[model samples]
Target: MENSLNTLHTIAFTHRNLPVSEIGNLHIDPNDQKERLTAFQSAMNLEELMFLSTCNRVEFLFVTEDIVDHRFLHEFFNALYPKLSETQRKLFADSAEDYTGIHAVEHLFSVASSVESMVVGEREIITQVRNAFEDCRKMQLTGDTIRLVMRHTIETAKKVYTETNIARRPVSVVSLAYHKLRDLNVPLDSRILIIGAGVTNTNMSRFLRKHGFEQFHVFNRTFEKAEKLANDLNGTAHKLSDLNTFDQGFDVIITCTGAEKHIITKEIYQQLLQGETDRKIVIDIAIPQDLSPEIIAENNVTHISVEVLQEISNANLKERSKEIQHVEQIIKEALYEFDHNHKSRMVELAMRSVPEKVKEIRSNAVENVFHNELASMDSESREVVEKIMGYMEKKYMSMPMLMAKEILLKKR
Candidate 1:
């Protein structure tokens, strides 16, 4: 059987190497992953695979014996993303950062621990990694090796967060947006219009609500989702279609959605303003911002965007960098533990057939070799002999595995 651990590799296109805009090009919708990733994995000859996509990063973690060089990456993107133009494909292949074996393990640990995030110490990446692994595992794209790695990765992340101060003074985009709005001295009762009740907006709205901001009107593509967030904020819900007719003036707009284009066009913004010239706060945390650029330039709108938040995050990272050394030390220990555990699991698998073989040997002794002797034994004596042999059989099944594990663990 293949030792998938030794062949582990990761091809990552993240904010580190590419701009956030370019990283967005690599996103695969969850609805399309089952078919797309399955075929991609088979085409790439990966034994096991997991795909993780976040706002700022997209990574392919897989196990295969083939070396991951420029040629391998060219073929990788060609097989997985054939729709891309030749130049786009070559750009991705050239830009990808690849890691193999132990380096791959360390990278995953860093990712789950949030040390590798664009905003260092943001805790959301751990949940993203976990959900991504579970999704790929459900699609049958991952097997034992990836499973083991993720398990250790999560454990290591938990330890890093628990033992270190990396996550202190939370500085996520949501919090940054809240701080910006507060600095504007916007009244708590100011009308808040929220567009798209996705995770980012949900968190942002909830943070505002917690800070005593009560007036909220949530509009989403799905009325039900809109209602859900509206109820949480004790506000009103409107379908996204109602945005044009939403005549109620707003003091602040918190918008983040998965739309490819601007959800708030120039016309929509004009109608939303209701002829009021007073300045408004608009927080567009979406990757491809929900608010149109024209609206920001032409109107009395103070816009807080993902790009602005990234600038703040970059500064926050310097404060968080003090904890990176401690986090990396934990990750180093986790890598060693994973290695030992992996070898022990391999030994356990290698010894799995021992029990059946021992059983077969005992059967041969009692049923074949000792058949005539057992036929002559009295009933009481036969029972005693059977008990002794059964006891011996149990020992024979367990002893070798125990001894082997002990020896292997000691060597580690």
Candidate 2:
């Protein structure tokens, strides 16, 4: 159950590790995610690392040049969260999991496939994973190991989607939210207000549009994003600040935002409820949440958070039990691929290690030659020398990675 199960170093700190609220402390601001990654790279000096932070989880997939133990992980977290409380620190220190080698590949593949989602088969996670991968690419943080694992992860996950019904029914958070809104029995032509113009809201709008609901008012912190989404949805845009002042009341409201504080607090709810009499439903898809609990207590309004949605979705997810075994089979096959590739790569590295080291020393010697022999030379000549060294280094490291069968046959 604990992540320490693996001896090789691949780590994950997720909802399984701590409560979401506690996980909040580990939350890196989206803007600061790259900075946090840079800090991890500098501190760990790892062989390879991939960082994934989502509303439901924060995962760190890494490899060390040498085998490491629990203490190495504890110290790693300590540096990452120096300000954590004793309890918070223990949650992270004691709970972080590392699944060494192929196990790491399996875990990542599971995540990419939505086996780890609160809602079993949420599709949005696919986008989130891709975004995380692209971010690492932008920061130039992805290494050869991470690239192979992520590519396999995507492939394995997509196979699950195509080959199974696990993703069927009301399995995603967005679709579940839409189901809840429909169950409210509000009129089809009811006035609707959507707060925040992110992905969830976009999906909600498209769902509503398909259902023939055209009366929509969109609001966001930035008027432009809201206006753009509004235009896309065939609706009017309003400033998020207009929540308190808007004279007309919508029959239903949906809000999902990144704001740390409740955008629809009790006070704001009262103002929104001011002008006219109408029953309302609020679908809050935001993490850190958008609507306060008190909004649910108001007589005419229903507030549905992600937790609420999960509870409702659980009943529908039961049918997916049969599909899990198939998913497991897919994972098993991916693990096989990962193992085969990893062993071949390892053997290649092992057989060539001494030669590689000699090459490394030669590289150092060449660098010295550059400094001493080429230093006094013309700029163009020195550039040519550097280019030649680059070419040789590439050639030396470019030997084919081989599986045991291939290596054995070649030996024969």
Best candidate (score: TM-score): 1
lDDT of 2 by residue, 202-255 (tens): 888888988989899999988998999999878999999998787666788888
lDDT of 1 by residue, 1-412 (tens): 2254669999999878777767767777666789999999889899999999877789999999898888898888788888778888878888898888778989999999999887888888898899999999999999888999999999999999999999998787678888888899999989999998877789889999998999999999889999999999999999998999999999999888767568899999999999999999998877666788899889988988777778878999999999999998999999999988887787778889988998899889989999999999999999999999899989988898888878877876
Evaluated against the true structure, the overall lDDT of model 2 is 0.74
Which stretches in model 1 have alpha-carbon errors above 4 Å?
A: 1-3, 274-278, 297-300, 369-388
Displacement of the residue 159 alpha carbon in candidate 2, Å: 1.4
lDDT of 1 at 365: 91
Instruction: Output the number of the lDDT-best candidate.
Output: 1
lDDT of each: 0.88, 0.74
